[model samples]
Target: MNDQYELLDSGNGKKLERYGDIILDRPCAQAVWAPRNPGLWETATASFDRVGGLNWEGRSKVSKAWNVEIAGVVMKLSATDFGHIGVFPETRSLWQWIRSALREQAQTKGRELKFLNLFAYSGGATLAAAQAGAQCCHLDASKGMVEWARENAKLNGLQDAPIRWIVDDVIKFLRREVKRGNRYDGILLDPPSFGRGKKGELYKIEDQLMTTLDLVHEVLSEDPAFVLLTSHTPGFSPIVLGNLLRQYHQSGTFECGEMLLTGKPGVNELPNGNWACWINTFS
Candidate 1:
């Protein structure tokens, strides 16, 4: 199966993707009843045999590995959950927000900052913050994902760096950090649509987000760089996310909007996901 979805050409029933040394010819759910390209179909590096699973076709020569590069940050990608790329390309927009917040905070505060990334996945935002002059603690519930994040850090030559890789449930970790009086100046959260924590700490974004937002609010110092919330959940709107931030943090100029993908008008010209940004403008 193609670990990274390199949409070589996508239309009607299938998407052609170049994954590492192999090409992928697969059916897409979104391509309902589209034309079938038999010629292009034969050139697949691999193909997922079904929906939401990574089964392959063709003589796949490489291991199941993928990488996404954005703004000089390299993210080693893989499917940690059902069929999800831990660091999806749609998330580049969120990384930009993280970079913007950190850069602005560094200039104004005249010092570095500490960053907290919850549900960090493969460290796309962590790499961005660390390279932007923030000491970041990357947290996730999956050990494999934490390892993937660590590999990405090293892929960018950031191994042995001051970054802390914590493999734990996000809520539990945050609670302990709060109790220890530890705080962060910059925070990034990319919650799932609906899932359970390692210890089964129920997480339904629509139901649990408001409370989590309030929890995250308490962990932020009075003077924070920025707070970002990115949700790929189909039902959660960016405005609602911003509303939650406003309700909880009450400080800072809160602005929430979708992360727009910048590209030409044809293939990749759409905002893939939503992001809400809150800058503590209380200077």
Candidate 2:
């Protein structure tokens, strides 16, 4: 739990969160229960919804961009038109896990680890890996996001870290990596339900996730260290992600759980998404 961020309360299709000094009320389709502390929500600085198209009320109260440190990584946050605040707080745990995993592998191998991150929005995982002494390649379809990630790296004083920021389609990038004989010890992906590549290439998760995983396997090192998969799309449960990874590596240690937005005592932990990870014990 980071002091810079907190999930104050959530329910009735919305969530109240505090990032640094700003409190935001945002849509949470999965928060079907009733809010525990309705009084706390009035303190929110801003709120976003999609009733009459995507919009944010009290937008003037929020700065154009702000910073928050979560899981030991500094992230730049902004109220985007798509309702994202540049960082996914639920993934904070994943970043910590990645850092620990890579640190352990680096010690065992006695060398830097090569890590790959797909759909690496804002570069939280990439920074976590870099901080753990891994050479990281962060790829996202949006150039703006790549630039945003770079800024975040600079904010953390990791601008000089061994990181390759690229804006491209995930599948195309992986295919090229495979062709060039580029291999990674660890890989992470957080694909969106629907997205477009830099070149207007459409991506539908249901139709392409298997193909994406296949390409991911091709770029993995012979002694891969780990693979982490997370998603916010409905029905893509932790088991579904575990089953997908199982198709490629059947012997690794598998861990799966729901990604949650949590706060201090008395605040209900909200399930934001799901995650599945496979770690190579023999590596």
In model 2, the runs with Cα more than 4 Å from the true position are none
- Against the correct fold, how does model 1 do in TM-score? 0.82
Clashing pairs in 2: none
TM-score of each: 0.82, 0.98
Error of 2 at 186 (Å): 0.6
Q: Mind giving the per-residue lDDT tens digits that candidate 2 earns over 10-32?
A: 99999999998999999998899
Q: Give candidates' CA RMSD values in order.
A: 4.1, 1.1
Compared with the true structure, the alpha-carbon lDDT of candidate 1 equals: 0.71
Off by over 4 Å in 1: 1-44, 49-54, 59-62, 66-68, 78-82, 260-265, 268-271
- Local lDDT at 220 for model 1: 88
